[model samples]
Target: MDVPADDDPFEAQRERASNPMRRLFDEYGRERSGTFAVGVAASVFARVLDLLPPLMLGIAVDAIFLNESEFSLPLVPDRWLPTDPETQFWLVVGIVLFSFLGGAVLHWFRNWGWNRFAQYVQHAIRTDTYDAMQRLNMTFFADKQTGEMMSVLSNDVNRLERFLNDGLNSAFRLGVMVVGIAALLFWMNWQLAIVALLPVPLIALFTYQFVKTIQPKYADVRSTVGQVNSRLENNLGGIQVIKTSNTESYEADRVEEVSGDYFDANWGAIETRIKFFPGLRVLAGLGFALTFTIGGLWVFRGEGPWLFTGTLRPGEFVTFILYSQRFIWPMAQFGQIINMYQRAYASAARVFGLMDEDAGIEERPDAAELVVDDGRVDYDDVTFGYGDETILDGVSFTAEGGDTVALVGPTGAGKSTALKLLLRMYDVDDGAIRVDGQDVRDVTLASLRDTIGYVSQETFLFYGTVRENITYGAFEASDEDVVAAAKAAEAHEFVTNLPDGYDTMVGERGVKLSGGQRQRLAIARAMLRDPDILILDEATSDVDTETEMLIQRSLDRLTADRTTFVIAHRLSTVKDADQIVVLDDGEVVERGSHEDLLATDGLYASLWSVQAGEIDDLPAEFVERATDRGARAETDGATTDQ
Candidate 1:
């Protein structure tokens, strides 16, 4: 099936900008009031400690060149240290040890605070995204593929995790390091500091240019990942079909095409990384060289005004150069961070897009609980459609409690569509459907669904034991209740015959079970729910004749004392219904008791004759009674003659 392109230009733009990395700072800023503030505090402390080494080096320079000058106090500037070299040496040693210990403590707290903040933010975003996924309506699922959804939940979310764990923390540490080093350099000699930072603006410009160039490539990579995921999902889902049709080569080729696209995308990103990282490294190297050459010349000549002022010294120059190199490392890393941010931004946009989808169907503010009193259902002039194509016209029907109404129609005749409406899978476009005198649209979805048991033609069972699948809906059901429901659905015998009895694993979607067995398990599941209303949609169409008979018997017992709605292609199934509805082209053409509809000799009668193999094949005694009723009706002139 060809997927339709999303037509909204705004939606396309939103998708393009959904990268996780682009929004990292926004994500962090949102938490700035709490843990982020703590992180900032710790980072400030860490940066303050980082400046100590350069200041200590400056003190050592003063101590060596002017021994008494280093020991001067604020109030007594002329006071000198003791003449004994040993006393001054021990004092300097004590100061050095204290500074080292302070730096260590600050470093520990900084790391602890920043890491905790990242974890908290990651948790919040992940929870919010997952919650949004759950709240999204069925239409979202209909439009998006399952594999794409999985990618958002798993891969995209994990990218954000990586950003938090490494990217954000790394950027924070680097920023602190750069600011601390810049402050130390300014304190040592403002002129030298200016020279060292001359290349910074150019480096920033290069970093921005590199990010701009790589953003599109990373976006392409993200798209390619989605495509590859979608292909894998399709192939895995249809593996059985491919094998049966001997289309392995065709499927493999398709997978390769998608995989190749992903490879090309990554290759482009790699090229960008290669070019940008090496260029940034060279720029950083040049900055380091310039800092060394200029600072060294100033120190050797001792003629630079800042050095002559006694504010700057030889050892201080050396330490400032070392600190400048430290600043350059983070400058180099800025390019890598930009790369990570762009990729993360691409992923974040996709995840946020999913999070932003509005559920088309939602409970009204005044929605009430479903009151299942005898399960009476009334469809009042209902109309529904998918997009522009109407699947059901202004159809109306009423089914009393304990009545079994069967809908017989050709494919696409709105039989299943009507059931979907009754189940509230989709709300009617025009009119309202009422259950127990309450409008379905005005009932809480959970209460409404709990009151109806629906069994579709395709039975879906989770990977679990027979008992678990059967008791899925009513988890608190007792062993006795489970056994009784299974027995009522004619599933207990087969289940007990399995190797593990009720504990036997069903595999994915009950692939371990035969078609009949899966259907029976589904029936048992619905039976356990014991809902007031039951919907059986083509319940026995896929089973063999023998299995159908067994299932029919089980269904007869299951439908008793409940409002049952059955959609079937075989007219025989509807023959015993209290009222049979024949639909065509989204309109109900005929409706009445079996005998009355057969007597009418209309669409329903024609379909019944064909399905029953002959008009006479329907019980001979019943046919005779129907003929007598028809003759009386004709004589009375109260009804039209067939």
Candidate 2:
């Protein structure tokens, strides 16, 4: 089993970037430029149109109602306006109607464009992240949980979508309103505009503080989310085990602990966020209150307040109040926008961090496809390990074409590890493994693996109908061929008896099937694969003696003309093997046919004698050694199983 990494509550925080949003824009912005451009245009149009009614209202108040100001508009030529008051009233009504109608239409376009951009970008991010994650080596995956990776694809990716949809849209809309209102306010009266915008720096400072305070909290929330998901996934997957072990309360405690962590983290961010938004409104309200007090005095006295000298018309004061309030709302909303942006930033960092994670192995650009010629496999002085402990040392062996070579050893003897090297699950540390005189690493991984068939003690089946699982890798296998393969593996009887026969659904990981049944199905799948070379690592370890005999008969026939390697715990299973190489503590101690090894009477003979119920025939030194080895084997077996 692989060692698990310690849980880091600040794991996502470590990936914090200065500008992950910029990275997101760079990667996917070009792809969705069409929708993004349209969305931006619509936001500009709608927000600008929203300012029209206020502008027209101010003009109508002065020119039409009180006649305190001339009938003048900002951009229109004076000659274009009507000379009489009645025509000016009609013109204001028409402009207001157009503003409302045009704004509604643009709003629809805004929602459509932003929604499409968000959904498409979210889908692309998830797919790309999953692609990057799945291609990483087993070593990388060993320290990761499935639920943690899924959090990136699901929670983090969906968070980015929300930011793109609501956060980005709000940002554009508020930006237009703030700019448009400020410009209009300044144009109407620059002195009052200065007084109204007094709280701008304070708002900016408060927002910066809010962002700084909540950034780490959001990261903690994201990290805890992954932790909670991992716990749930692990518990749900092993529910059967938990029930069998009567650990319901134990599992519940674990769930509660992780969930509690998430709650605390999320609430911390929520607390900060709640305080920030209302605090911004108060700061914004300061500007609104200041504008009201000063503008009211200016309009009442017909003079600017507090040393300012200007004729303050009632309509201009009214326009300033309206524009200043709009500015306040946008300033307040900047808090909400920043909130979403921080959340999305943490998620983006995680998504990009996973994408940037390094892989353990890489294929050369010039790697060639492997073509089998007799499948002559060789291991010359091969050595490998995990971490610092050596699992295999100076191991050398060969299985020439059409030969049946058996690797027999106790548990943790590196038998399975040795076979994995052929598959390149882990590369050798010292020497070379070649097939047909070509180094396994020199060829493209796909072609090399495609030519080798492997069946191990632990069998895995995807959730699907029996037929689908059997034909998994060999998608083109005919019904006749599938039935033939099942029959050959002695699985046809059990399969036909299952409910719905070959069409029966196997639950996740094939939990619906028995151990022997799953093992047999695995054999049938390998038979359908029909590789030129085969590696069987304890393939029959789970089956009954009767089933093993039946499978052995089929295997005997299947390997007649193909190169084969077998690793078996039950030495009797490999008695007929052409060559039996005995491994003890990673070194090959005995090598010969069954009879030849027995005559030498070494570790192999001691093991054979003990298994054959001839314990008294062994010497004292060999007896103590055999007993110790047996104890070690059992201990190792239990460890491996766990």
Candidate 3:
């Protein structure tokens, strides 16, 4: 099978981005760009105004204790201010109250903008990821587990939202505080500012080292989360099987084993994260202590005429002390910001990576819709494979309009592969499959599938009422039409006898019903579709003999006016096919009617004899092949013995 890049959903993109997290933001954040800018601007203004209160307090101390001789405003000259000391104190107090009020208003705007932006991005990513997954070919799904995909869509995507809302907002808030405080401190006294900022470079280097070490550990943690989810999902889905096998303890041990692996992986990352914060606090503490000691000595000097000729007034020293105390938190918050970004980066790789995968089966831009008048299908020298192992080679066959063709072969003989080709589930490596002279690959996938109805050996029904399951493909079908299809499939009588009749809920995969009942509902679903081409891959194989006969009657009606292909193991099911094509090892080994091939005494004859319990009359070579195929099918759990 030609797998998609999403076989590993975290595969690198073709045009590798230097920063994937930034790319993700640009892609989904374009719609909310105005709101995002507003949020950031509000946070910046709030931090700037928040610094005003400390400056006002320092000025108030100078006016009250040192009097008008030492008190002097830079912007407001002595002529504009009140001469009384008490009036000056009240004027400064009012300005401080106004600053606090402005900060509160800006903080409100910041919360609204960031919260709305986070919600919109989360919804967009989840929907876009699901849409991409649905467009991929079946081979991609076969290579992945359901739980692994769910983990990316649910858990990983949610992580991105948390970072954008809380982490990114906090980062910007702390950034503004750090920058604003630094400028104010330097203006107060450059010498004291140097002491306060001395530890900043060291903190940055320490955070850089922590980020580099924790990144790979977080990647490992994400991978282990997927494994644990897969194991739990698999066990829950097959709980009935485990109970019947009496392996509850065995399954419990397996769950514990994966859970323990997740714990160890998470704990390893936790150890690295826990060590980072305390070390950051120590650096922040050093900056605080150094600034306090140096500024106190300068305050005692009264003018700093002796200490390097840089004079620091007592009021300015008070301002520097208050501002330096506020700087420590932003430095510590910077470390947390790095931790959140690393987590968001890993999740972005998986979510955006899935969205970047190429579709294996893509339609040409100019491909036209399929026009099926009589629904004739032809496989002209078709050859295909999964990886390097060929499944169908030089396989040629034809089914004329309104003809029934049956395919019979042993296990893994490419019987089902041939039917799937006509549906364009997997394109042929060579040659072509056509509907009414139009190549399948050349036609629109939707129109081609719309004209064909398929019922597989493994019947699957969704978790819904009988009416919903029957009308799944034909969503706009009327109640009368649904009843008509159910009656034709011989399912109406039993469906009406259930607890809620047609409204009864079928558990997941129709587990609430027996195999035969689920099989009948599947046929009803196909019958309601009413397509021009029908493919039945052992459609009645799951039912009992009596139910099979009932379904066979319905199949005859459904295939009366359509080109139908049947894949069967029981020779009795396809004895009346217009053409019978027998395959062995991906090649068309026998081609003829039932009676003509039986008279030829070839491989088809031997298979028919074995199913009919006439093995003694088979030739040595034919009997030996049949015996080998039967033993292999039994070991592989393939139901080909019948």
Where does model 2 exceed 4 Å of error? 1-6, 9-19, 609-642
Model 2 TM-score on a 0 to 1 scale: 0.92
Q: Please give the range of 10 consecutive residues that has the lowest summed lDDT in model 1.
A: 1-10
Write down the TM-score of every candidate.
Answer: 0.85, 0.92, 0.91
Q: What is the lDDT of residue 454 in candidate 1?
A: 92
Candidate rank order under TM-score: 2, 3, 1
Best prediction by lDDT: 2
The residue pairs in collision within model 2 are: none
Error of 3 at 178 (Å): 1.3
Candidate 1 local lDDT, 1-642, one digit each (tens): 111234221145346454444465575547644666666676676666666655655556666555624443223344455555566556556756777788788767766766676667667767887898877665566656666667667777778767765776678778888887887678667887887888799899998888888877776776667778888998898889999999999999999987887798789889879998888878888888988887777767765644334445576676777788888878999888777777677777776676666666779999988998888999888898779878789888889999999987655668887887777777889988999889988999999999999998888999999999999989999999999999999999999999999999999888899999999989999999999999998889899999999899889999999999988878787789998888766888888898999899776776677676776555565466456756755775652111
Question: Order of candidates by lDDT, top first?
Answer: 2, 3, 1
List where candidate 1 sits over 4 angstroms from the true fold.
Answer: 1-38, 54-58, 61-124, 305-312, 605-642
lDDT at 8 for candidate 2? 46
TM-score head-to-head 2 vs 3, winner? 2
Q: How big is the RMSD of model 2? A: 3.4
Compare the candidates by TM-score and give the number of the best one. Answer: 2
